[model samples]
Every structure is written in C-alpha cells, then in structure tokens.
Target: MKKETGLRWLFFFAGLMVLGLGAALTIKGQRFGVGSWDVLHIGLFERLGLSIGLWSIIMGLIVITIASIGLREFPKIGTFINMTFVGIFIDFFNWLISDSNTFSVQLIAFIIGVLLLAMGSGIYISAELGAGPRDSLMLLIVKKTHFSIAAARTIMEVVVAVAGYLLGGPLGIGTIVIAFALGPIIQVTLKYSGKLLEKSVKVESVAHGHG
Candidate 1:
C-alpha cells in the first residue's frame, strides 16, 4: 500500500515537472503563441514585475482557493504541491532553456509543448492524487453543470484568453490552437493513462501477492 502511494507521488511530481517544462517552452515560443493561462501569466509578469512562474503559482493558489471554497472541500496535499512545484519548475526550465530564434524551431517547440501539457495533465491527474488548480475549477464546473471536459475547458480558455488579452498579453495562433486542441488531447491522454494506471496497479498487486 505504501509503495502504491509512493508510486502515485512519483507520478504526481513527474507530471508537475513536465507540465512546467511544457509551459516554459510555450512561453519561450511566445512569439509564435501560447495558452490562455500563459498569456495571463505573461501579462501579469509584464505589468506587475514578477517572474512568470511566480505569477503562475499565485494565480494557481488563488484559483485553488476559490475552487476549494466552491466545492466546500479542502485541497489535497498533492494539489498544493502541484501549485508550488509546477511554478518552480517553470522558472527553472525557462531559465535553463534559451529562446528559439528560428520560426521552425519555435513552431516545433510550441507543438511539443502543447503535447506535453496535455499528456502531463493526464499523467498526474490519473494518479488520483489531485488535480491542478485550473483543472480543479474545471472539475467543479463539470460536477455542477454536467458539462463535458472539452466544453468546460473551452469556456474557461475563452474567458481566460479575453482577460489575458485585456491585460496586454499577446493573442495569436497559439492561443487558438490551445483553446481548441488542448482539451481533446488532455481528454484522450486521460483515457489512455487511466487505463494504463489501472493495469499497472493490478500488475503490482499481482506481483506483490505472488512474492
């Protein structure tokens, strides 16, 4: 049991790091475009004079706090970890990886970033630890409104994009891609990863039993 829990924590941390890296890539590829939350992060950073990653942590905590209130449930430890570490990882990676000069390189980075964001989202959430701040709000909407994940995410993206744009964040093709594409990818990743996690758990149980 302890091992299983530890495995989930490992998955959770891995997912947060990947998520931060993906976000960093998209931010560095900002000339090409970025996701809604990233746009807001950039906007906040530009206007408020803090690192983008710091803004990410701040915004995440705010959202998570509100979500917890709305759901009337305390956040899980994993949720807090997701909020904190993802931001740290983002800052660390952003500092480590320099910006892309070429359009082709930027495009490739953006695409890979998007894929990683979606997959990372699934990988962590599937651990049954806790959803990230934004995703927690999304789940709240899902539970209350009976909306599908795609629809809920789309709605949130639109609103967040508008807010970011108003705050002077660049809105471009990348935003469009994220608005439309990310939800489906995340949904698919969740489906597959969930199945995979289940299989792994069962395999672990069997191996331990035999041992």
Candidate 2:
C-alpha cells in the first residue's frame, strides 16, 4: 500500500514538472501563443512587475477561491500543489529554454510542448490525485450551469483568451492549435496511461498481499 501510494506521488510530481516544462516552451516560443489561461497569465505578468510563475500562482488562487465560493468546496492537497509547484517549475524551465532563436526551432518546441502537456495531464489524472485548480473551477461551472463539459470549457477559454488579448497577450496559431488539438491529445494519452496505471496498481497490490 505504501509503495503504491509513493509511486502515485512520484508520478504526480513528475507529470507536473513535465507539464511546466511544456508551458515554458510554449511561452518562450513567442511566435505562437500559449493556451487560453496561460495567455491571461502572460498578460498579467507583462502589465504587472512579477515573474510569469508568480502571475500563474496568483491567478490560480483567484480561480480556486472563486470555485470554493461557487461550489462551497474545499480544494485537495494536490490542487494546492498543482497551483503552486507547477508555476515554480514553469519559471525554472523558462529560464533554461528561453533562447531558441529560429522560427522552425520555436515551432517544433511548441508542438513538442503541447504533447508534453497532454502526457503530463494524463499521468497526473492516472495518479488519481485531485484535479488542478483550473480543472476544479471548470467542473464547478459545469455543475452549476448544467452545461456540458465542452461548452463550459469553451466559454471559459473564450472569455479568458479575449481578456488576455486585450491585455496584450499573444493570440496566434499556437493558441488555435491548443484549442483544437489538446482535447484529442489528452484523450489518447489518458486512454493509454490509464491502462498502465491500473496494471501497476494491481501488480503492486498482488505483490504486497503475497509479501
């Protein structure tokens, strides 16, 4: 049991780090815009005098607070960790990978970054940790309005993207790609990773029982 729980945490953190690295790549790939929420974060960072990660943390807190108010919900420990640590990881990775000069390189980086983000999401979900703050809010919106998940998410994305654009965030091809491709990518990643995690859990349980 301990081993299984420990492995889950390990994978959870690994997924968060990879997700952060992907976000950093997309941010540094200035030719293409990032995801809708990230656009807002970038804009906030630009107007305010703080690191991108700091803006992300601040925004995440706001979202979590709003979610708690609307749903009368409390966030899980994983949610807090997701909100804080992912931002810090993004800052660390942004510093490391901010210097790719060529357009081709930047485009490639952006594509890879999207894939990483999807994979990270899959791994984290498979860990059975709580949803991230943004996802928690998304769920709350869906529940409150009786909207389909897709509709609720679309609404949120559009509002945030427009606000970010007004605030001078990049609004470009990468954002479009993220809008269209991420759902499918996450679905596929989750399908495969879920099986793997399930298998691992079963194997560990059997081993522990025998021991």
Candidate that would win on TM-score: 1
For residues 83-160, what per-residue lDDT tens digits would candidate 1 score against the true structure? 999999999999999887888888888888888988889889989898999999999888889999988998898899
Per-model TM-score, in order, reads 0.97, 0.92
Model 2 steric clash pairs: none
RMSD of each: 1.0, 1.7
- What lDDT score goes with residue 92 in model 1? 99
Give me the displacement of residue 10 in model 2, in angstroms.
1.8
Summing lDDT over every window of 10 consecutive residues in candidate 2, give the lowest-scoring window: 148-157
Scored against the true structure, residue 20 in model 2 reaches a CA lDDT of 91
* Candidate 2 local lDDT, residue 139: 79
| Model 2: residue 209 alpha-carbon error in angstroms | 2.2
lDDT of 2 by residue, 82-104 (tens): 99988999899999875777899
Point out the worst 10-residue segment of candidate 1 by lDDT. 2-11
Q: Candidate 1 regions off by >4 Å?
A: none
Candidate with maximal lDDT: 1
